[model samples]
Target chain A: MAKVKHHNIPLDQIIKPENIVFKRTKLFTDNVLSYCPGCGHGVAHRLILEVLEEMGIADKTIGIAPVGCSVLAYEFMDIDMQEAAHGRAPALATGIKRTNPDKFVFAYQGDGDLAAIGTAETIHTANRGENITVIFINNGIYGMTGGQMAPTTIYGMKTSTTPYGRDPKQMGHPLKITEIVAQLPGTCYVTRQAVHTPALVRKAKKAIRKAFEYQKQNKGLSFVEIVSNCNSGWKMTPVQAVKWLEENMLPYYPLGDLKDIGLD
Target chain B: MIVGAIVVDTERCKGCELCTQACPFGIISMSEDVNSKGYHYAYLADPYACTGCENCALVCPDTVITVYRMKVEEPSKAKN
Candidate 1:
């Protein structure tokens, strides 16, 4: 006997661009961000807003804002956002997405929030194949707590917690979250990109859109790690921080998609 | 007809070929010359035929292409 199979259509094909793009009434009319001029978080915020606007699901989306620099995301973003404990955004997102399956759910987390105190939550959320988008910003330091050391911190990098530079012998090596998460069977898409330059920023946006696309299709977890720069925390000018990220960090975490399950 | 120049930064070019494929006017083409990274870079063969749509620059993977439109002179203005 022959068996029947089913196919799923992509959301991009179903949703028209006019409906997805943000309307003037839907955008937040706020002043410029207080973040340093070159902070990647600000760019990330704009990209998320653009994605939400383009998807035309701002009203149906729930963003779980994690602790760190983005704690004040609610003030800037027009969408409904719930504050989650440090490193608990993923866990909160999991519950929100599972219960409200129809809504688009996402968690915005920083390196310290996702790789340190929330490692277990991050792993379990991805491992369980939660239908949610995880936007992980790896800036190599804890920006909110005044430049503290983070799991993604590079060797010889000095932070508030590592005043004498990060000693690999004691602090261990930097964590590659994308590589680790890509190994999980539940994860449908895993990518690492940066927003330091316009070219890179475009790629980051595409990766972000793809993650959300996977979530909309109920294709399980999608993790996108952005190599962000914390200019203020790094004690460097915004331009210098962007240059540093492009030269130093890019060599360590080269941008590109690590895995694509091709659910769409 | 006015002609335009299409500049490509070989350093940033990732050779995705999306720009070459997106050009509806078929003015842009990929060159056999490999960049430092051993990837074929994109170039324009027919500048006069460029419609200035900028679809090539918009779709370039590395954002290396820059399309500039040259102003066209009218017959009356040229005579003056």
Candidate 2:
């Protein structure tokens, strides 16, 4: 049988109240995602907004966008947002959460911003157990400023800066910042997840929601490390990148909950 | 069984094909035609097979796909 063509049909004529199953959340501005096609950042951004909308705290939430690929997150997220300097999102979130204890606070950061330049701020913030949530995107490279080796770039992984692949002898080892924070007494929840597949997307959303719920209960700092793909930075197509992430990235940065309240 | 349909925002689609990969029924495929962005967007190749599970919209980075599902009414249950 021949397939029906839908490009000629108007969207309104296709969508109706009785059959509508899913619609884009209103928390996201209509600004088309700026990230490269197939990049994980956009999905991560949607998951965060969906959580905010589900929790009924979109108006009461304040997001701190880090100086990385998501620097313009303030423009995309409909809720109130603040842009933080390179690696300073944690520090800013710390201050904001302290001042506005009643509001839900979160910092969205990339690996470079959280593991490289923001190491000091990140550690101290988690150590202090600031009543906030940190959504960390670990794509293992500096995507916005062009592909470069990041602290979380797995050993032997190739980035533009590490063309021949990362060398621990010259570059140093990959940093497990999420695990480091989980050991801190201040942090109440810490987990690692991905959004490349349908099952993982659902799990990632649940992790995001759980992190926010922890913040609402004032349970110290909740950290969610989303091990994601950077298709453009890695010089691979979106589909290829997702496959590479599963084959190469997953073994090193395995997914699952690292720490949770009463879960050890 | 429930029948599903989807509205793809051709202008917004990046042709990533994640939706095609996510469709459990293998009903979605890249279109032969290109949108304004010069990319071959995803389209419902076998719309009748769609179950409206929403996996396509869930993984779409651009948030361009809106899904719909319809439960066909049964004549036997119409009396009730």
Candidate 3:
């Protein structure tokens, strides 16, 4: 079989359920992912889909994707997904969760979409305890719009809008949106995770699964922030970007749970 | 005998080395050859050493790795 002529391995061999260790979840569509070569969005999307599949909630859940790199989330995720205007995913999710309280609802957003343009909606929705899960992808730049500085961009980071690196005097500090929401009483579970390494990816997936579990319990708003990477925007190889994230981003946005009402 | 296999969607791979770093067995490596997308891709360089841990697949942001492992039956105690 190894000597077979370059065609894909026998379908039966690949699809044997007993031998499979890891494969794509049915919640993911046939569509190939649209993210850059090593962007963390792909891992994050797959983890959410896998969680839905494991929980058997693919048919009873709705996802809201706002503008930013994640705007096309509906194309890749097979579950029912809706597009929200820039930064308005929380608002759209709020409505959906309110009307369909029994169904699981989630809003997937990027740093620019959630911490910047959608800050008001994000804060308010979580403050109100909307019974929805918010999956925030923070790469510290506006990836889809060409790596402009986002609210999460750390000081001294260079982005298209911050050619000389971000000057705290001019741009203020990088917003800790997760911390902000965690302080609010509406949120039930708040955690920050990453997907750059195998250990980190597993932790991130577990966090997402926990968020879904919290939402299913109707335990107010559950916020899970994934500190991801954008290799293209960062002008680094996938390997380099992970290293850079460890050196720079992790210090500022440490991984771990900020608040867990579940434990209370 | 081989106990595990990894399949990559070569055309979809962007040659990110996340999988390379994730494989504890050091089995994955980047190919010098370019895929149709004009990017280097990752490949399994040491199939025999693979434990089918699936860590590479978990860290791959491109969702390119599919892992399969043969089920190993436990060996019975040797006859006295």
Residue A94 deviation, candidate 1, in Å? 1.0
Regions more than 4 Å wrong, model 2: A1-14, A262-264, B73-80
Q: For every model shown, what is its TM-score relative to the native structure?
A: 0.71, 0.93, 0.92
Q: Which window of 10 residues has the lowest lDDT sum in candidate 2 chain A? A: A1-10
lDDT of 2 by residue, A64-120 (tens): 999989999988899999999999998999888889899999999999999999999
Query: Sort by DockQ, best first: what order?
Result: 2, 3, 1
Q: Candidate 2: deviation at residue A123, Å?
A: 0.6
In model 3 chain A, where is the ten-residue run with the lowest total lDDT? A1-10
lDDT tens readout by residue for model 1, A2-85: 121111322233233332222222344354344543467766876777788888888899988889988877777788899999
Per-residue C-alpha lDDT of model 3 across residues A47-73, encoded as one tens digit per residue: 999999999999999999889888899
TM (chain A), candidate 2:
0.93
For model 3, what is the error of residue A92's alpha carbon versus the real structure, in angstroms, after optimal superposition?
0.4
Off by over 4 Å in 1: A1-26, A29-31, B1-80
lDDT of 1: 0.76
Evaluation by DockQ, superior candidate among 1 and 2: 2
True contacts kept of each: 0.00, 0.58, 0.64
Q: Relative to the true interface, what fraction of contacts does candidate 1 keep?
A: 0.00
Ranking of all predicted structures according to lDDT, beginning with the best and ending with the worst:
2, 3, 1
The DockQ scores of all candidates, in the order shown, are: 0.04, 0.45, 0.42
Q: How close is candidate 1 to the true structure, as a TM-score?
A: 0.71
Clashes of each: 1, 0, 0
